[model samples]
Target: MNYEGAVYRPPSEARSLIIQVTIGCSHNKCTFCYMYKNKQFRVRKIEDIKNDLDESRIQYREVKRIFLADGDALALKTDKLKEILEYIKLIFPECERVGIYTSPQNILRKSVDDLVLLSSLGLGIAYLGLESGSDTVLENVKKGVTSSDMIEAGKKVVKAGIKLSIMVISGLGGRELWKKHAVESARILNEIKPNYIGLLTLLVEPETEMFKQIQAGEFQLLKAKEVLLETKELLNRLTVDGCTFRSNHASNYLNLAGELNEDKERLLKQIDDALSWKFGTKDEMYRRL
Candidate 1:
């Protein structure tokens, strides 16, 4: 595939065929993000994307899932997205599901009707990052969305019959607002009750603004114990059911996975073990973003 720069997707989408529909993230101003810093944001030409799809059809046999990458593929207009999805259905008849990175702004810009139309066209899931549910933390990191915005966007995806996979950063609020971050995030997730919740711990890159803040003592990094404490609070407040939850990301200190409510106690106990030094935590040398 003709990729412009670094491509990222949900870990669950590891085996899917990745197609770069957009060059970079539409809003790359988030202080914690460094993924698209080297690339400019732009949607590729319809014909060029089609060409890549055509080439992939010949190179790969029996492709089942496709993930649209290069940051927020859902930014494309409904008509344009419909055209690309239609072509995918035409060429990859066996493709069971399609997924994409989505931003709250993009999700809200498109009407419910637009989202439903795409869902009917085989767009199976969308990944949204709700780094922190605290409005102060959101504005601090420049995520460009409030907790309300996150809830609205998440509900829209669920309403459209599209699976919503949300990412929540464990220590985005750091020491200053850790409790608020944990409880408020759980409240937002409880409201939306997304299909999946992928928990990630905060780790700053030197190139990003967050790194500067840390150096200046403006923000704090939660230690392993504090992270577990925050996570425990978050999980404790979560009352959602049937949603898949995973915290085994490379940046995380703990590894956790299970269905919500059903395995809530088990997950909390695992965190307690880690906090109490009974269970192991990932070493800093091996932990990464």
Candidate 2:
């Protein structure tokens, strides 16, 4: 496949075949993100995309999954996305699912009918970054959307029969707003009730605005115990039934995974163990973005 600067997909899509349908994030203004800073945003040519698909058919014999990359594949026009989906069905009849990353703006741009059409055409799941559900944190980080906007967008995706995977940063509120961040994030998750909820801890990278803020002593990162306490509070507030929750990302201090409501107590107990120093967190030296 023809790849661009940097391609990113959900960790669950680790084994899937990836193709860049877009060059970079269309709204690459999140202060915490530096993933696509070096690349310009643009939809790839339809012909080039098709060529890559054709080459992939020749390369892999039994492709089961495909992940559209870089950042916002759903930002493409409805007709254009339909064409790509149709071609994928024709070329890889056995492919079971196709997933993509979508921002709130991308979701808002597409009509419900457009989303339904895409879902019907084998677009199985969409990964959305909620970042933080606290409006203060969101605005501070320039997430470009409110908590309510994300909730509405997530509901739309679910209404269209597309599985939604929502991600939130654990320490996004920093030390000052940690409590509000935790509670509001849980509130948003309870409202959306997404199929998947991924909790990733914050890791400020070099060259990003967040890194500069940390350097200037403007933002205070949460300590390991504080992160656990925040997560426990968030989990305690979460009431979404049947929602799968995961916080096992390499960036997370603790690895937590289970279905909500049922395993809530177990997860909370694990957090307690970590807080009491009975269990350990991922070493800070090993954490990554």
- Please write out the lDDT profile of model 2 over residues 55-112, one tens digit for every residue: 9999999999999988888899999999999999999999999999999999999999
Q: In terms of TM-score, how similar is model 2 to the real structure?
A: 0.96
Against the true structure, what is each candidate's TM-score? Answer: 0.96, 0.96
The collision pairs in model 2 are none
TM-score of 1: 0.96
Per-candidate Cα lDDT values, in order, are 0.92, 0.91
Q: What is the lDDT of residue 256 in candidate 2?
A: 96
Question: Which structure among the candidates has the greatest lDDT?
Answer: 1
What global local distance difference test value does model 2 have?
Answer: 0.91
lDDT of 1 by residue, 31-115 (tens): 9999999988999999999999999999999999999987899999899999999999999999999999999999999999999
